[model samples]
Structure formats: structure tokens, C-alpha cells
Target: MTLIVDQSTINIQVLFMVNKETKKALIEKGAEIIYLKGFNNTGINEILEAASVPKGSFYYYFKNKEDFGIQLIDHFLVRFLSGADRRLSVTKSSYIERLRVFFDDFLEFFKGNGFKGGCPIANFSLEMSDLNENIRKRLDTAFDQMNNKIALFLEGAVKNGELPEDLDTGLVSNFILNSWEGALLRIKLTRDVYPMKLFYNFVFQDLLNFN
Candidate 1:
């Protein structure tokens, strides 16, 4: 037997599809806004307006503002991690060289953006961690994952004899991540790229102890 779907059912499905698209667009727009202006300063209406989505649509997609914030954090983390992975996996560069490329790319990003803001993770960690447990946990996991990737690189460096075998890779990884975050904060505060350049130089010359 053949079955037919009603026009009303088709219309409802189409509406749902449209609503889902609208929601995705709004979430993406909200993520950009949050990255630039921050979580505390961003307003729901502002996000909706920026996205050009109506209030009904916004609420239909997200339970509340905080829910959207969480989604934004997840999206940002995925994108950031993917970029880092690509940079670290470059075929032509040595493990140590890839690490240096990572630092150079970060500093170049700051310079290219005119140092208006630095790392989104660092920004969100400072702003959202104090007020939201859920966001704090998400940020913490992302940080740990990032540090682990760096540790893996450091381990490769040690195997290649680029880094000393006796060094604690885990501690060195955390130290680099922590120091970079601090350096980004200083660069943002100073509105200058000097801090980033200095940090990059120090990481290569002193921290990594590259010969």
C-alpha cells in the first residue's frame, strides 16, 4: 500500500527545518559576539538582533541565554582545537619546529588582529569561570586537552633529543600553556604585540632550551 503525507505535516516539517537553520545561525552569530564582547557584556536581545532572528525563534532554539553561552563555548573549543591540530601536524616541520610555528602563528594572530583581543579560551576562563560551574568545567576540559597536545609535542621533542630527556614533559606543557595565556592577557592589556613577540622569543630561546 502507498502512503501519503498531509500538507499540514509537510508544512510543520518545513517550519521545523527553517527554525533549526535560524537557530544555528543565531548560535554562530552569538558565538562571534561573545568572543569579541564577552559573556557578561553580551545581551540576548543584542545577539538576536545581530542574528536578525525574532524572540520567539530564539527561545524556541535555546532554553535561556546561558544555554546559548554553553553552546558557543563548545563551538569555539572545537574550532580552536582543530586549528591547533592542523598546525602541529604540518609535515615539513620538526616537532620542535612545529611547536615554534604554533607560537609564531599565535603571535601573528595577535598582530593580524591588531591585538584587540587575544585567546578566546583565556578571555572566557577569566570571565565565565567565576560565575558558572558548567562553563568553568567545559573550559577546564578544553585547557587540559590543549595542554595534553602540547605535552605530546614535547614528548616527541624529547625523543628527538631536541629537549632534555630528564625534563618533566607534563609540567613543561602546563607551564607553556599557562605562560602563553598570561602573555596574551598582558598583550591585550597593553594594546601592543611586544609582549607576544617577547613571549615567543623567550619560549624558543630560554623555555624550550633549543640549541
Candidate 2:
């Protein structure tokens, strides 16, 4: 009888793989902490304790809190952009209907959070823009990219004859994004969703109904 052992299989088994779940926990916990405590006020030990991740692991993944913050901003953009792209993409619903649905859903999300944390990008802008140039630059780029996404959809609406051909898509998109961010701040202050609901009503009811 001859017995053969596969050395490659053993080596592969011994190789350590990064724990994706642990890394994700760190990011998610860190984000929540930042929401509760402003970024500058948030301590590294708080995040580590909340995530149950070791200090070495955090340093291995991030150079420092600033690096981690950049990543968090990136994470927020990815999630927000994906939802925006869906609502603004071509669909059977009219452009106005799509806009209504989008804002309504956003209002519902804010309500779910009890109007505690406002937009993450907006929060970062208020907190870190003056203090950290790198973060401020990243935030500026992110806001510009988000504005572009809105402009792209508005352009599509113009092509589909849903909006006026001469309408300034760029300016309109900028106004809409800025208005929403302001509304979010008011919602946090009042602990009410009426401000957001009012924004939706104004935008879709009066602003977009130029026919």
C-alpha cells in the first residue's frame, strides 16, 4: 500500500487570509462613532474597542485616523452614488415621479435614523474642511462627482423631452444638492422629517412643473 500526501494543500491551508468581516466591522463601527462623536473628538481606542479589533490590525489596514477618514468618505460616496444612480437612471417612471420617489425614500431613511445623523459628506465638510486640507480636497471632489451624477440624469431628462432643452442642468443640480444638505441639517435640529418632506414638495410640485 502506498500513501501520498499533498504538500500544496497543507501549505494553502496554513496561509492566513484577511478577515473581511472584521475589517468591515471596523469601518462600520468607526462610521457610527464618528456620527455620534465628531471626527476630531472620536478616539482611536473607542473605535478599536467598539470594533473588537486589535490596534495592530487597524494600523496594518490604515496609516492613521486621517487615512481611515478618507476611506470612510469613499465608502459613503460609493453607497450614496449607487442609490442616486438607480433613482436617476432611465425607468418607466417619469422624471418627476423618479425625483419624488428618490426624495421620499431619502426622507424615510432619515426618519429611520431618528434625524440624528445628517449627510456624512456634509458632516465631514462642516467638521473637517477647515482643519484638514487633504480631507477638504477629497470632500470637494466627492461633492463635484455627486453633482455630476445629478446633472447626467437631468441631461437625460432633457433628451427625453421631459425637461426644457435650454435648462441649465449643472446649475440646477448644484442647487438641488445644496438645498437637500441644508434641509438635512434642519431635520437634525428639529428632530423632524417635515423639512425634508417640504423640500420634496417644493422641488417636485412647483420647481419641476414648468410646462
Candidate 3:
């Protein structure tokens, strides 16, 4: 099996690698600025500067700020879910325990950040939903994906006998996500974890009926 690769193919592969790194850098830096300043408040120049990309090449990488915003949402989801996947999948315990730890992990993440930059998805949802339909729809998909992930965790709990088979995981996951974002919003203003702590307690204790 002689797998002979061509020079043009090799060049294309190298270009893809370069472009991928550049794009990821833009999204990462853009996320940091947008998370703090907000989508409207953030400027493309600022993002390019933070990313160390040339000022004139923003269009080469993205159609415009709105396009960048969509990719930024994707990068945020991937980074967040990668961490969550580790916490949920790598452990040797029931999904119920893993799910609880997943929440706790994010709780600690917020506490460590001093409650700054509330949920990026929620922030973008509020800022862009009415202003741009395209961005709003992208944010909607991101939120749905999050809900689906939680629903999967709940389904796992049921399979493990930690939750009732008849439990409505879809409804429960949506509620849990809503409650979490609401708590995050409150925590951002309060600069305290009390709201999140309360949210956690109500979900795991009263709602989930965990002892």
C-alpha cells in the first residue's frame, strides 16, 4: 500500500493548519473580550489586537463581526463541553454522582472567577436576540445543545436507577438549564455565589429528591 501524498496536497494541509490556528486564536481572544465587554460593546479591532492578528485581515477570517460571533459561540461550547465531558465521562461512578460533580465543577469555576462575565450564551442571548435574527438563531441552537447535554445526563441517571424511569428528562433538563442561567445572572450582580448555591440546593435536593 503505497500512500503517496502530493506536494499540492501537502501545501493545502499546511495552510489548513495555519488557518485553523489563526481562527481558533481569534475566537478565543474574541470570547474573552466579548464575555467581559459584551457583543455590541466589543470592537473587531480590539479582538484582532487581542488575537495579535493583523487589523486588515479580519474579513479574511470572518465575514464580519456577526460571523465571528457565531463561531465564537461554537468555540465556547466546545471548550465548555470538553471540560464537562471529562468530568462526566472519565470518572468511575454513577451518572448521578458525575452529574452532581459536573455542576460543582462549574460552581467552583464561577467562584474562582469572582462571578465575573456571567454565562456567555445568556449574555449573547440578551444582547443579540432582538438586534439580529441570525445571531439570535445561532444562540438558540447553542442553548438547545446545552439542554440536550443535560437531558443525556438525566437519562443516564435513570438508567443507573438514580432517577425514576418515567421522569421527564427533557422537561427537567430545560428547567435545570433555565434555573442555572438565572442563578448566574443573579450571581453576576450580587458578586456572590449565594444565588448559585441556592439553585444547586433546590435542584439536587428538592427537585431531584436526592438525599
Candidate 4:
């Protein structure tokens, strides 16, 4: 005999599923707004209005604004890391080519967005790190993770003779990440992509000198 499910129960389950998606959509939208405008500049009302989510629904998903900010950072990190992992894992590309692909993707994104907003980590670190210890620690961990991942890629390059055997992978990774951050800041200040392009060119040429 087949077991029959209650229609009312099914309706309740459907509503629950929809509510979960709605909550995720709200958080994603809220994160985007915060990334663009910054945490301090993005008021709760604006996020709620932008997400078309009521205050009650926001509270249902988040304990407070700080909690929401943490989740937002986590969400952004997942997306960013996933893309980086995909680019770095491509088998057909040389290690150096993979690195170039990574940087080129970032450059295209910056150019596409008109460099209106900079890296989300950099933006959040500047805005909330001073005021929030938890957020500061999270941002710090994210940066460390990014640096480590790049360093691992560099280590692979060295292993494959793509880079100098004696090259300091850790330092090189830090330099690249730090330089990119600085380039992004310059882009924001100058309202131009020339600085970013120059940065990429300098980095590419410098890496070629590794042999």
C-alpha cells in the first residue's frame, strides 16, 4: 500500500521551502548592497527595502546587523574562493597561465564595474575592522586564506620549473596580493583603470623575470 501525504502538510512544507529561498535571496541582496555602499553607509532600512524583505523577516534570519555582516562576509568568501579554485585547477593551462587567468578575470571585473567599488574584503576591513573584533578576525582569516592559496599555486609553479627554484613563494604571493589591493585602491582614488593595467603589466613582466 502507498502512503498518502497530507495536502496541508505539503503546503506547509512548500511555504517553508519558499521562505528559505527568500531568506537566502535577501541575504545575498543585502550582501551586495553592503559590498557596494559599505556597512556603515548601508542602512538596515535600505537593505530591507532593496531586498523587499520586511524587518521581521530580516530578524527571523539574523540575530542582529553584526550577525548579518558576518554571514555576508562568509557568503562572499565562498563565491570568491570557488571561482579562484576553478581557475587554478584548470589542467590545460600552465601554472603561470592559470595565474594570468586569475588576474585577468579580476581585471575584467574591475573594468566591468567601472572600478566604482573595490575589493569587498578591503572595503569591509577598512570600515569595520576598527570597530568590530569578530569582523576583523574574520577578514584577517579570509586574507590569510587567500594568501596561502596563491602561495600554494606559486609553489606548484616552482615545482614545475615555471618559476625559479629558489623563489620565495610566500613572499611572492604576499607581494602579488598586496600589490593588487593597492592597485584597486589607486583605481578607486583616480577613477581610472590605467593604474590597474600598469600594475598587471608590471606584475606580469616581473614574474617573467623569475627564470
Predicted model with the maximum TM-score? 3
Tens digits of per-residue lDDT for model 1, 4-73: 8899999999998998888888978888788789989988888899889876667778887778877877
Q: What is the overall TM-score of model 4 with all chains considered together? A: 0.90
- TM-score of every candidate: 0.85, 0.87, 0.92, 0.90
Instruction: List residue ranges in candidate 2 displaced over 4 A.
Output: 1-20
lDDT-best of 2 and 3: 3
Which digits, one per residue and each the tens of the lDDT, describe model 4 over residues 1-211? 9999999999999999988887788778888888788898888778888888876677877888888888888887887677789887897877877887887787788788877788888889999999999999999999888888778778878888888988899898999889888999899888888888777788777764465
Candidate 4 Cα outliers beyond 4 Å, as residue runs: 4-16
Score each candidate by Cα lDDT. 0.83, 0.84, 0.87, 0.84
Clashing residue pairs in candidate 4 are: none
Cα distance off (Å), candidate 4, residue 204: 1.8
Candidate 3 clash pair list: none
Better of 1 and 3 by lDDT: 3
Write candidate 2's Cα lDDT for 107-132 as tens digits: 78888989888888899999999999
Let me know the TM-score candidate 2 reaches against the reference structure. 0.87
Q: After superposition, how far is residue 94 of candidate 1 from its true place, in Å?
A: 0.8
Off by over 4 Å in 1: 1-20
Q: Worst lDDT window (10 residues) for model 3?
A: 82-91
lDDT of candidate 2 at residue 7, scale 0 to 100: 94
